[model samples]
Target: MISEFRSFIAKGNVVDLAVGIIIGGAFTGIVNSLVNDVVMPFVGVIVGGIDFSNYFLPLTSAVTADTLEAARAQGAVFAYGKFITVIINFLILAWIIFLMVKGVNRIRAMEEKKPAEASPAPPPADVQLLTEIRDLLKTRA
Candidate 1:
């Protein structure tokens, strides 16, 4: 059972999955930073200086706090702005992945389109003659 487990863990797919998970975690952080730091700021500026993450509806009358965090601290709050931001992040990430896949597919298509290397041209006439002479000598022997 232990050997079976070891073999399973050592499979190519398992290793690939592990690598993918690690890379995906890192990519998520980068995408989050891109959304939070870069994209959101620009979006805010374009739509007037309003922080989207701070926008939320208070579900409880007790929650009068303006910011989403403070509102959540006070009582139940519907944080739709955060949801919107997350949706944007997902869209961006999806588009990027789609583009990467497209590029890879295009490269693969190009490679497929390329003709296989032609067989080496027939040996030069003199080389062919030498080969015939050698074969004749072998036959004679």
Candidate 2:
């Protein structure tokens, strides 16, 4: 049973899945940074310099702060703008992956649809001579 489990774990599909998961986790961090550090700042400037990370309403009795952490410490239950930002990051990553997969599929489809490009065959000598004879015969006729 242990050997069977080891074989299952060591199979190509399992290894590919593991690698994909590791790469996906790393890609998530990159996308998160891009969204938070790059895209959001430009968006904030466009939207009148508003920071979405602190865009939360205070409802707890200790309403003495304007930050999400302070609101959370005061037992607030508002949806975090950071969480929404992360969700958008995930969506954009998924879209990029989808577009890449679509392009690969299109290339594969075109490859399949095309006829195999074979090298042109050399003309046989007998056929070439016959062509000359035919041309001469036509001129004589």
TM-score of 2: 0.71
Residue-by-residue lDDT tens digits, candidate 1, 1-141: 999999999999999999999999999999999999999999999999878999898998999998888899999999999999999999999999999999999999999999999999999999999999999999999
Task: Give the lDDT of residue 56 in candidate 1.
Answer: 93
* TM-scores, all models, native as reference: 0.81, 0.71
Worst 10 residues of 1 by lDDT: 49-58
Candidate 2 per-residue lDDT, tens place, 1-141, comes to 999999999899999999999999998888888889988898889989978888776666776677888778877646477777768787878888999899999999999999989989978999999999999999999
Q: After superposition, how far is residue 6 of candidate 2 from its true place, in Å?
A: 1.8
